[model samples]
Target: MSLPQPVPPSWKDLGKSSSDLLGKDYHFHGAALEVKTQTPSNVAFKVAGSRDSKTDHIHADIEAKWTNKAHGLTFTQAWTTSNVLRNQIEVENQVAKGLKLDLATTLSPEKGHKTAIINSVYKQSGFHTRASLDVFKGPTFTADTVLGRDGFLIGAEAAYNVTEGNITRYAAALGYNAPEYAVTVHGLNNLKTFTASYYHRVSRDVEAGAKAVYDSKSTHGGVALEVGTKAQLDSSAFVKAKINNSGVVALGYTQTLRPGVKASFGVALDTQKLNDPSPVGPSHKVGVSFVFDS
Candidate 1:
């Protein structure tokens, strides 16, 4: 069986900035705006700030990009400041017909700061593939004090086409880091996760699938199994629902508004027990979210 060709890269960028200036007592006392655009890739800037009776802060960023198809090279850099300064740079190359390599580095300048560097290379040929990786020290969280918590996360994923009508995907991941707050008083905490999913199209615009997920931490572990079916309602709308472990269920709906706009909303309800005790009222939350994408 032959797999479908990958989609070509598109030139696009998106970003959002918002601020709240009013205190909690006043409901309509903040300023906010969202901006998006696609133009010649050279440099772009955005600024957002708030100063009133409550608090004051400012944020700004600058980005640059350069892509050359003939040379098979791409470069990108971004710098931002809100409460702290951050800078990142990445370089990628199509080293061969079906091979690619990337090198990237990031630096944060502040009290007790540090930097991180990584190098990765990937090769693709038919259904078989290979990759190499290397990484250096960096901060574990955005708000760091001594940079002593630097660590690394490593993982890989692969997929294969069993035949013209079936495909499978599998992945494994691991990480090392400072003792989690939970185990800081108990001991060091570690985590590992594995997942696999399979899909087969019964007919055009229709499909059925199942997935399995396993997650383990220093303190607890759990497994979930899920299966579902999907069908297109029309050219503008569709719906999907799934049943998982312990009778938990999720439902989702999506609609296309225009040629370049779409929205999605979903809700999930679950009845599962926690492996450990909790101090909070409930172990879960029920809410709705609306998202816009173009």
Candidate 2:
């Protein structure tokens, strides 16, 4: 359901074209606190929080997830409790806790409430199917099916909004996949989005990709080009870089620190305003992250 479309512009984004803002900005911070855990038997939990220095504000959340994969059956459930500290978005402060509650939290018309969603997937030989439903003020249901083997695949998805009393959106995708290269094309019926991506493995430890996306119903329409590469430096370290034609460049590095700890750092720069005499605001950011496991 190519949902979350027609996104509102960023706080102070300077992109002249509507397509420039088609994608949401990745949330990055100079520092933050995070913790994660997983059990041997399909259970996991996470608690994370961070503050915005300039705003003197904090956002925090706790989430728990468990999946059952025994007896040829797959079922999963997740629950979250969030404290959206900012008053910027009325709903965020009121009912946006546990953000991943799916259609209820994601697309339900009703705002500021607890959300619950369930999903189950079934697979056999050359086919797989998934069904999901969310409990917000009203239930929204989604179903998707795919048929494919090792070399090729195709799928379609449809979602129904019970609260809105109508079918919300539909999507279809086709792709070809192999060990060395892959390509895919997909579109959303609701948002007028067309996206295609291609990837190729240059060797065992290096791969590159290019993606093109066009969407809009606003500002006429726009397109973006992104190219990226990831390469393994050794057994426990790697680096990644991406350049977007619109105006940004980013690079990241990750390394394992110990048996169960990992660290990462990244930076993103807006190339367009880097040399401008009258810059609107901060044009770059650096972020640090750490993960620990039992």
Candidate 3:
């Protein structure tokens, strides 16, 4: 129950805050087609009967992006089978314009035949900032000691934005994980997380937000709070809603079926009470996307 930290846009002037802090030169490519169905009041790893199962899933993604005025790069590759996990590849890079550097990596052998790697580097000069980290190790057996026991993770995120509309943004991030990592082979491991968020913009096509999250695991330590709203229905239609940290509720929609095509749909409902509990389910997804520019 941890996913909330994306809500920052509310400009009151200065040509909408210099077109939202100048930076543009974009490229996009996309693909998605999905099918999912599940009904469970109780089900965990075999022995079925509470009746409900319909699964057929397919996913494909392709991305290429570039940002000028300094440095920015993005590359993505994704594939999915069904009942979770099929194939995956991810790549991310960001340079000085975003701070110092950023990196990400993931290779999946259908979820458990795993591979993961994460690296982050950041340094700032106005209000102070710093980050240096590493993650994920183990599995890919015998490719010369499988690159020496893989799973390892480290984290950092420091913040200070007393005023910038980029609006009064504040930040704090912490991370740690290592226990012969393969995400501890599904039982995850000694992990920790702390997050904070805020954004304000109550006009111009209405926008509102809120966030707070804390997680510590090796069994459980949880805290979650989220509030969201984003509306812009004229340039192409959009909507969002979220509620997490166990008392699940999510709704999403996006539409722009012309100038390069677009379509999206999302729905989720779950009322949590752990110990192999994630039922009382309702999940739906639909996506049709396309973007190409040269």
**What shift in Å separates residue 288 of candidate 1 from its native position after superposition?**
5.8
User: Scored by CA lDDT, what does every candidate get?
Assistant: 0.39, 0.60, 0.34
Measure candidate 2: CA RMSD.
10.8
- Candidate 2 lDDT score at position 122: 51
lDDT per residue as tens, model 1, 131-238: 322233311111101111133223334333323322233443323232221001101112255444444455666655565556665255677677665667899876
Winning candidate number (TM-score)? 2
Please give each candidate's TM-score. Answer: 0.50, 0.70, 0.22
User: For candidate 3, what's the RMSD?
Assistant: 23.3
Off by over 4 Å in 3: 1-28, 42-198, 208-230, 234-262, 265-287, 290-294
Worst 10 residues of 2 by lDDT: 85-94
Candidate 2 per-residue lDDT, tens place, 1-294, comes to 433222221111111122222222223456556788888887677776666644647666665655543322223233323432211111111122212212213222345545556654454455666667876635888877767665567777888988888888888777776658767777777648877777777898987787888886647567878877878899988887778987888777878888778887767778987985533236776667776766
Judge candidate 3 at residue 23 and give its lDDT.
12
Model 1: worst 10 consecutive residues (lDDT sum): 13-22
Better of 2 and 3 by lDDT: 2
